[model samples]
Target chain A: MTLVDEIKKRSVHVDAAIDELLPVVRPEELYKASRYLVDSGGKRLRPAVLILAAEATGSELKSVLPAAVAVELVHNFTLIHDDIMDKDELRRGKPAVHMIWGEAGAILAGDTLYSKAFEILSKVENEPARILKCMDVLSKTCTEICEGQWLDMDFEKREKVSKAEYIEMVEKKTSVLYAAAAKIGALLGGASDEIAEALSEYGRFIGIGFQMYDDVLDMVTPEEVLGKVRGSDLMEGKHTLIVIDAFEKGVKLDIFGKGEATQEETDEAVRILTECGSIDYVKDLAISYINEGKAKLDALCDCPEKELLLQIADYMISRNY
Target chain B: MTLVDEIKKRSVHVDAAIDELLPVVRPEELYKASRYLVDSGGKRLRPAVLILAAEATGSELKSVLPAAVAVELVHNFTLIHDDIMDKDELRRGKPAVHMIWGEAGAILAGDTLYSKAFEILSKVENEPARILKCMDVLSKTCTEICEGQWLDMDFEKREKVSKAEYIEMVEKKTSVLYAAAAKIGALLGGASDEIAEALSEYGRFIGIGFQMYDDVLDMVTPEEVLGKVRGSDLMEGKHTLIVIDAFEKGVKLDIFGKGEATQEETDEAVRILTECGSIDYVKDLAISYINEGKAKLDALCDCPEKELLLQIADYMISRNY
Candidate 1:
């Protein structure tokens, strides 16, 4: 099967598991709000990473499906809260949870998903020691994720952010969950500690690359294809790596942080970034990170699932929008 | 010792454990914001319950201290989030976390505390199976707390809420954490399942009474003693059992849900509710629940710690604030 087909084959199980594990029960409105953003369309990249990591370790997908679902729930929970924090109104082409349910409702919805993630993970059929280890990994990752978001918001208020600070923020905010996914999948599949640690590194590297490439896409992708305004992050003054690199190169883009730009102005800014090599700089860095992530798979035996995992890492930067 | 002194004796250790287990690290401001309300002087009742249950089950204080700290953190986490959702400006006689750190900061802070709770709980030295069980209990309790909060916000929009519905909300919102605390302490302390379950029931009953009496104290206590506006719940139109009973008896409360009421108006409403026996009815009901909770302690052998647990139940309703 193609990479997308392999991912979908596993993700369909994740979708079915979500319904069975997290049903819309009492206080129907709350459950509905909690399920709102979760059910909306998004590529199930995180779950796919988890399932592939487990399969690469010679485990069946069914054995680690709940852990995959738990990781996905954690991802959605962060999105719901992050949208409220960033005041983003749309997610996955739908109104953010806070927009539909109001902030209080959205807060509760996110909180519910947060707890349910743990609740579901604890029920996974595994040795208690392994399950406890996964719980530890997931919880610590969540704490790091919170720290990352704090750094992200903190960076936005300041006039300058070093590349090191930006990468640290990205690692914490976006990458740790992926690390947790791979590590958790490996642990549940009864991989050795060394293999689990390597899988976690694989996830961490690729997750960073994925986020960096996302910044590149935000600058270059068209409005219709991106599903939101192109270059919106630049207007919002977000300190993505591309912006930091361009600023270092002394590239003058008048529309940066202006909150709005005409199409021509946006085009001009993109052209300036391209000429400065800042855009390509980020693209090259993202590729290097993805390559580093794929290198971690050397610990795994030769298997079709390992090849699929390598392909997923490439897909992280290769997918346009 | 008096019940106050007894609880303080145990709570002191919990206070120390909090400092050790949840220290201010990198992202100093975020950790500071998370620690703000936690270090504030609320009576450490939940931790007291956990430690006391552990002691009653022949466990040493040092062994279960982290679990006690974990429960305390979860309580503070809920308070931080609930303050934002309720728009209550003050908590523990100071500004809420949101007031100091902004809503986004408060949200992240609460989320940090939440993951830290699970992270800390998972590290307690114990059998992995028992620790995993506690994780399940704690996570499920958290989900129930969210449901309870949702029900509370849902009730505010409606004109009437039945006693059953109010009890259910209270059980989920206010009591489940207490239940988890007692159960976790017992499990970690090596108690039998039957004994652990009884202690959980003990916590559940007293917690319900604690909240019910809290409503009564809101009416009868002076502002200086209560440390918040007396009858604020009334003005805010909270559907406490006292209000539900008063409404059932055709006692028209003019100041109810008025958002503000003069002292005279508050006093008049208090007198009307008193005369109709709604206040006394709730007071008696709270006492009965506490009694039921104390009765659950019969499962334990007679010991000083068990005696204290029973006294703690009585103190739930008897304390002025």
Candidate 2:
């Protein structure tokens, strides 16, 4: 079976687990808002990747279900809050949590999911030391993600943001959770420190590549597929890697950060970005990171699961959006 | 020392510890907004309660400093987000974080502080089992706090909320953190489970009484003292125990939830509440809870710290605001 089909088969289990675990609380709107995006559905990629990582280490997949659900909840928590912060009106082709439930509802929903993630993580049925270690890893990653988010917002206001700064932000905001997921998966699967570290590095590089491809998709993907405005980041003057690279090449885009830009102006901006080869430059960087991610998997035993992990990395750079 | 003086002395240590641990992140606004309420200052009651609880169990105060700081940070985080959700303009005599930093900034600042609190909690120098236990207690409390906040917000839209329902909401929203702080401090300080549970009960009861007193203060305190609009809860139609009791007493409040009511009308509403004996009824209940809280201290050994914890319970009911 193809990697996508394998992922789909595994995601069915992950989705069912999450559905059962999603909080059922009084004052139903809070739980409803929290579950909204989860129900609307996406690839469930984080949990799928996690289960695959655990299985690759020759461990039982069922034992790692709680951690898998916990990571995905954290991911969704970030998305709910990020949408509110970005003031985006749609997610997964439905009204964003904030747009539907209002900002206060969205904030509470996100917070509930966040705290629930840790609560769920605490129940992972591990040794006390390992449980504490997992909590520490997840907590530190959470801190980094929040800091990275602040930097993303901070970048929008600043005149210059280096590629290094952009990469660090993406690593913190986008990649650290993935890194932790793989590391924690290995740890839960009883892998040695060396193997866990290798898997973590793989996830980290792949995460960065996934985000780079996301940056490219923002410029190239249509609004219908993307679920919101195609170039909302550019309109917000976010110094994504593409924007930073374009500025370095002396290719100034008219619509960068201009909230009032017309569709024609945004199209022109995308056209300029494409002509200046910034999009291709970002795609190349994404490919390189995916390659680096796949290389880390060489430490694991040669198995079908390991091959799937490699295919997953390639899929990161190759996806349309 | 007088109970107030003891609290003052303990608060100095808590404040200083917090000052040192507060995140000094880039995008200075997030940190600034977070520290804003902390810097402007009020009673560091939560951490002091934690330390007092530890001391009551004959535990070293120094060892639980990280836990103390963690609880305080979580308190401030709730304040930041709660202010935004409530749309209150002032906190601790300064513009609320959202007013100064914008909602997005405030949300991020609150989130940064929330994540930072757990990060700090993980650093507590305790046995792995104890630390993990603390994390579990803290995580569960965090979840309750979010749920309670949602309920508080939800209560604003609904009529006929019961006193029992209001108590549960306050327990989750206001008291659980206090309960967790005391319990975790006891565990960290090497107290037995029985002692920790007793201390947690004490904190929980005191927390309820404290909120009851706060509800009373909203009517009696002037704006300068409360650092918010007087009767803001009433203006928002929050069915505090006072409101519920007033209704039971056949005292219909003309200014209740009338956001446009003149100051004279609100003052008249307060006068009627006082005249109908509803405020006094709520005050009696607050004192009862405080008395019950003090009773929990009977389980601990006789010591000055235990005496002080009893005095602290009394102080909770007697505070002006």
Candidate 3:
């Protein structure tokens, strides 16, 4: 089957499961604010990867659905809170939760989703020990995400952030969840520790690449397609790989974190970074990581599910948004 | 031991445990923001109750210390977020975390604490099944607290929230954690389901009374004693039981939720609520609930720990802040 078909099929399964799990409750606004983002359209990439990873390891689709839904909920939870902190007004082609519900409502909504993720995880049809391990992975990932966000925010104020530091932040901020998703799926699928670790490493690499591609997309994607401001990373003074590369390549530009920069100025900054070959530099890095990710999957048995995993990584780099 | 001394002793244990559990981490600001409020003084009431409840059920205090610390962490997590939402600048006699770290830092700090709570809980030395069950309760309580917060916020915009509605909100927002704390303590202490439920009921009742007493204390306590804004709740136009009772008694209250009301006007509102016997009425209710809470100890085997549980209930009603 095509990767698109597989993603669509798995997304529907995960979405339905999420809908069933999060019933609307009293004080309807909180739940509504939470469900608002969940109900909105997304690729559901994390859960799809999780389900695919489970399938690749010889597990039935049903076995991993709860964990799959859980990871998606957690992903959205982070998005909601991050949007609030970043003060982004748009998400997934809609007003962000904070925009509609206000920060308090958004905070509570994000928190509810965070708590519900664990509740759902506890209900996964697995032995208690395995479930505990999964919870530990998830909680640790939560801490890393927070740490990454702190670093991301802090780096904005720093004069210089090394490429290694930037990569570490993205790994914690973006990739840890993905790694945990794949690792959790593999673990719950009865894979041995070595196989699970391999899958986790594969996910970690792909996750890092996915984030680098996102950084590139922020500069290159259209506002309408990205569903938010373009060049926001530049405006926010975020130290994306392109920016780091440009700084190393002697591209003198002052538009970094220029919140009030005009569109022309922002465009010029993007142009400078692109002309300096920093954009291509990041693209190459993304490809390298994706390749490394695929190599880690060689530990798994050859299966169609494994092929889909490779295709998903390719799609991560190729997607416009 | 007297309740005060018992509280003091247990507070030291819980505080030390919490300090050990929450080691400082990288990106120092986030962890610092989290620990800032934690290091400030609190009565450690929840943890004390948890320890007392566990001891009452024949469990060693050490066995339940992690769960006790988890509850306190959860409590602090809610306070950090709620302060941001409420826009309060002070907490526990210090500038609220948002004041020091900015809203973004406070949000991440709270998220870190929240995730850390579950991490700590997952480490409880118990059978996996029991640990899972404890997690289930804690997660559910987290949801209820969110719901309760939503209701509290919703009630502010409301013209008249009935006494029953007020009770239910407090039950969700305040009592649920206490209930979880006690239930967790009982379960980890090897108490039977019946005994756990009894202690949970005890905590729930006391939690409700504790909040009601807090409402009264807000009106009567001086700012220095309360360690924050006194009459802040009234200023927020929250419908505490006293306010609700006065409204029911046909006492016109212009000071309720008077955000811009002068201190004199606020005092006048409090005076009216007090004159209408609403203050006494709520006080009676608080005492009754505390009594009811103590009755739950009837299910426990007689011991010094159980006697301490009874004293703690009385202290909840008698304390100023």
The TM-score leader among the candidates is 1
**Full-model lDDT, candidate 1:** 0.93
Runs in model 2 deviating more than 4 A are A260-267, B260-263
Q: How do all the candidates rank in terms of TM-score, highest first?
A: 1, 3, 2
Per-model TM values vs. the true structure: 0.99, 0.96, 0.97
Query: What lDDT score is found at residue B102 in candidate 3?
Result: 94
Q: Which ranking of candidates, highest lDDT first?
A: 1, 3, 2
Q: Which docking band does candidate 3 fall into?
A: high
Q: Candidate 3: which stretches are off by over 4 Å?
A: A260-266, B260-263
Q: On residues B1-321, what C-alpha lDDT tens digit does candidate 1 reach at each position? A: 798998888888888888899999999999999999998898998988898898888888888888888998999999999999999998867899999999999999999999999999998988999999999999999999999999999999999999999999999999998899999989988999999999999999999999999999999999888778889999999999999999999889999889999999999999998999999999999999999999999999999999888888888988998
Question: Can you write out model 3's per-residue Cα lDDT over A1-321, one digit (the tens) per residue?
Answer: 688998998898888898889988787788999899998987899898888888888788887888998899889999999999988888987899999989999999999999999999889988888888888888889999999999998888898999999999999999999899999898888888899899899989999999999999998998889987788888888888889888888788777776757878878888888888999999999999999998999998889899999999899899999
Tens digits of lDDT, candidate 1, A164-238? 999999999999998999999899888999999999999999999999999999999997788778899888899
Q: In lDDT terms, which candidate is top?
A: 1
Error of 1 at A66 (Å): 1.2
lDDT of 3 by residue, B5-66 (tens): 97898888888888888888788778888888888887888888888888887788888888
Per-residue alpha-carbon lDDT of candidate 2 for residues A1-321, written as tens digits (9 for 90 to 100):
888899988888778877777756676778888888877878877787788888988676777788888899899999999999888788877889998889999999999988888888888877777777778888888878888898888887799999999999999999998898888888887788899899999999999999999999888888888876888889888999999999999987787888757788888998899999999999999999999999999889998888888888888977876
lDDT of each: 0.93, 0.87, 0.89
